[model samples]
Target: MSDQDSSSSSSSQTEEELDGEMDEETNGEVEKEESHRDSPAQSLSTFSSSLRAVIRIKQKYQVMKQRRQEMALALSGAGTFPGAPTRTSPKIFTFDGVTPSAFPMLSSSNPQKKKRRRRKRVLFPNRGTCRSPPKQERSRAKYCLYLLFAIVFVQVYNAIENLDDHVLRYDLEGLEKTLRREVFGQQGAVEGLLVHLKDYLSTYVHNKPLVVSLHGPSGVGKSHLGRLLAGHFRSVVGETLVLQYYVLHHCPQEADALQCAGDLSAIISEMVERAEEEEKIPLFIFDEAEHMQDEILDALWTLVASKQSNEYLNAIYLFLSNMGHAHITKHMLHNSSSTSMASGRHSALVKELTPVLRSSLEKLHQLWSEANILPLGLLEKGHVMECFLDEMTREGFYPDHSNIERLAGEIEYYPAVGGHEYSQTGCKQVVAKVNLL
Candidate 1:
């Protein structure tokens, strides 16, 4: 029984130890539950802090990604530069917040390419554009056109100057002064002749030769005027260009008409050919044309009407005739009395007598119709006295007015109105009378 009781005591001790250990375990579990219930605010605060930190990190990541995308866009086209290394995708970037320019290897090549491209743009601005052709060539062509126009203008100016020179070489002004000074008592005849000369000689080109016909009575200065022209032309153009042919002297009344016509044509042709070779205009005087036969006139008409050659075109022909002397004298003595009335009478005579004379001359031959008719009017006693004075002076004798008046009075006069006597034989005997003096 003592051994049993000792065992029970030990058992009880063990049971108490066991109860203490259980009690300790239950208290630790209670403490742990109380601590957990009391720290709820701290745990909630830590969870909120962690969530805010995560949100901040996510926003920073998003911002960095956006900036990287923008940087990539900005640097995207860099690889497209000519002579640079090409990339499959231009948007090359790293998400480490490091730009492409940050690396020396990439930036060094990029600046050189950029400088090269800028240099290319500055140097070859229009290298591959629409205006790439040669501008200098077009400018040169424009300059050539300007030069061509200038050349043409200069040529035309020279042509005009040459024409002026041609007209000025004729010395027509000298001829006009000489006619006004020397010719007398026939103011209208002188003026008409001067006008025709000026008109014809102003230009060297003409379709036909000029033909002038002088008609009047005997001793009315027709032959005198012809002699004056022959002398004047001989002095002016040198004697080689003047041909004076008198019907009584060249082809006399007794000569064969056909032979005379042939000889006259040959002589005229030779003279014209010689004058043309010398580049000179010739003067042909055919005096006493009324005495010319039909065959001689026909030959002259053929020669004068020739337009076959330029040599035949440049000439002057004077035909002195007495065909209309009766009409010319009647018109002059009836109309004109003094020198003052001479000019008025001359215009009327030309108006009235030109048609009458032309018709009369056309009846003889059509060649005379084309002739420019100049009528010589009758001279008054005063004109006859002046003629006497001129002849006396030319013969180296003293020209006393009384002696000239006596010599003029000796000549017969036509019985006219107002007792204004007109000389019947005007200056025809003045030279012979002066010789006697």
Candidate 2:
């Protein structure tokens, strides 16, 4: 009984050991299967990243190729040689894991050696040279250039077509009479000045500056003559003749003689720069000379003198002052001790100038000595009457000589209360008398 019981125990122990070994083998097989599945998924991820990189490289190559072609076209238009050709397409290659035997295999050779005999050579072709772009890209570039030039040309032509002539409005009849009396009358000192002016203008045309001063009393008409001369020059010279007319009233409220220097300097610099660039001379006309600041006058002197030194600024400089010849002469003497004093006294005479301009009086004297002074006088009785008659004619009113003479007599006798006073009643009476005639 003891032997049978011991045999049963040993059999049971052997069965338990066999079951443990089978479990270990099954677990090992499961681990091997998991590792094999993970390998394929990792390979797929690597292939996807490589494909993306290749696509990016292809896109960059295409962009570079397009830019190269555009540059070539631009260089051709600029009359320059085109650059070297560039690759447009990506390259492709192929390889096989096979090789050819050096010697023919005999029927008696080893089977393994015979099986490994055949091999294939790898090939890599340049795909960039194989393909050509369509001709439409070249045509499109040419069309763009043509459109650009056409638009630019049209804009330039339109700008030139929109310019108009510039003219200022004033009393034309009064201006004409003022000029005739000052330039042609018997007692006219302006007659000698006229001859000198003609010579000066002739010299001015040959690139010489003409500095002229017109001085007279209030009613003697220096401003009217100045405007007339400016108009005459503009009418004959078609080139850009810029006119800068300065009056005492035109000065800004904040400006004093010294403070106005910057403004005046800027104006002169701008004018000179314009003249230099455009090849045009500028005419500077200063009226109401009595009101000009001393500093302003100094600036003008500097500009004129500096321009005189330069070959370019042979432009006309006109000065119209109500200050008489005595005033002008005294100012000149105080400013300069040169022969300008003799010339100022002999060439021009008016009444008297203000003493405020004494500081730059020498510059004024030098200017007068070098320049031609034209003195304007009052109108003659007949010329005055003729001017009135002409004004009446323009208004569509005709007057006989007898009636005109009666009206002239009234104007002459009551001149202080009537004609020259610029009254509405005076103008109406003159108009009525002309209508009756």
Candidate 2 local Cα displacement, residue 135, angstroms: 87
* Candidate 1, 328-365: lDDT as tens digits: 77766666555545345565556567887888788889
TM-score of each: 0.62, 0.41
Candidate 2 lDDT tens digits, 44-161: 6565655665565566556654554464344334442257332222223323222445334643476555454532112444557659764654567788899999999998766544
Residue 22 lDDT in model 1? 52
Worst 10 residues of 1 by lDDT: 85-94
Q: List where candidate 1 sits over 4 angstroms from the true fold.
A: 1-170, 337-345, 418-420
- lDDT leader: 1
**Steric clashes per prediction:** 0, 11
lDDT of every model, 2 decimals: 0.74, 0.50
